[model samples]
Target: MKIELRDISISYGKRAVMQSISLTAMPGDVTAIVGPNGCGKTSVLRAIAGLAGYSGQLLFDGRALDRPPKKSNRSLVSYVAQDSAGRSSLTVLEVVLLGRLATLGLRVTEVDKHVVCEVLAELGILHLAQRFLVELSGGQRQLVFIAQALARNPAALLLDEPTSALDIYHQLHVLEVVRRTTQKRGLATVIVLHDLNAAIRYADQVAVLREGHMLACGKPEEIVRPDVVGPVFRVEMVSLPGAGNYPTLVATGPVHGSQGAASPT
Candidate 1:
């Protein structure tokens, strides 16, 4: 399913956070949303997940959806939030199985169990299935949650800071797995990332948000350069040639002088 957000504006009472913004995510592609703190990145994910109210349209496969996802529609949209706090006695397998918790009835079907195991294996976390969520490391737990989302066999996968608390190794692992899964499953994936490099490496498209407004949206290589990224984050990005055709961005320092204070137009 393709996700299209047309002229979306979000607000609480009189306080408007987002205004007349539109972005699209095609199936078999990963779209990354990057912005500074309090820029409504999470809000955009929520709107698409049908958890938040908005003024504009959120369409799936060219049909405007006016309600939250229903099981009967055969449309599954999985959202993995940042504060996953899996402080429970549930084992990794059990927790991942709960991805279909909303759809399961009296008895668990073999197909559901099969999908759960398949996703775990794909994430390289099948060995940790017997381990308790509370007993695992931060990176392990992150993978477990990702497995949980994929287990739902979703058409669109929404993730919020999936690599926020991980080390460099785990960060790369999670992003790589996410990118691989998106392509393999032909899923429309929307991720909110704080790391620009991760966006450049994994995202097929990038949406740059600032204070609830999208400054730009397009290919990561074109939109993530120093000229475009500098004013949005107010940082000086020193670029270097990296692996493949991607440029490795290094933040030298904060933007200073009169131009430094200027915001992206």
Candidate 2:
């Protein structure tokens, strides 16, 4: 499925956050939203999930959607928020199984259980299936939540700061899993990333937003350059060749003459 946002704008009361933000997330590709703090990156995802109010058009497969798709059409999209908090004492398997709740009726079917286990294994969290959510680490819980989202088998997946608290190893592991799953499932995957390098490495397309306004949108290589990234991040980025001829960014210092201001005007 293809998800398109045309001239979308969002506001909280009278304060506008996102203005004329537009992008298309296509199936079998990962679209990364990169920006500075308080830039409404997460708000954009929430609007897409139908959790936030917005104006302009939201189209799915060329058809307009008035709101978040109804429950019956939920298989079309699944969202994973930044907070992985779980107050309940549910087991890992049970938590992941919640992804299938849209299809579940009076009882749990073997098919649901199978899908849960499959997603857990795919995320390398199968061993934690019987474990309780409260007993797991933050990173582990993040993985479980991702597995839960995957279990839904949605055509589009939206993630918010998915690797925030993860160590380097787990960060790569999770992004790799997400990218692989996105490709394998042909899902339209949109992720909000603070790490420019991660977005460059895993995303097929990149959209840069600053203060709720879109700066640019294109292929990763097109948008991850020094010129495009430096101003948005306020860092002087240098590129060095890496594996498969990919460019890696190394920050030398703050942008010239900015004097380390917290934010640019």
- Which candidate wins on lDDT? 1
**Local distance difference test, each candidate:** 0.88, 0.87
Model 1 local distance difference test score: 0.88
Candidate 2: clashing pairs of residues: none
Model 2 poorest ten-residue lDDT run: 256-265
Q: Give the per-residue lDDT digits (tens) of candidate 2, residues 120-219.
A: 9888899999999999977788889989888888888999999998889878888998999899889999999988899889999999888889988998
The prediction achieving the highest TM-score against the true structure is 1
Error of 2 at 256 (Å): 7.0
Can you give the TM-score per candidate against the true fold? 0.93, 0.92
Give the poorly placed runs of model 1, Cα more than 4 Å off: 68-75, 256-265
Q: Mind sharing the TM-score for model 1?
A: 0.93
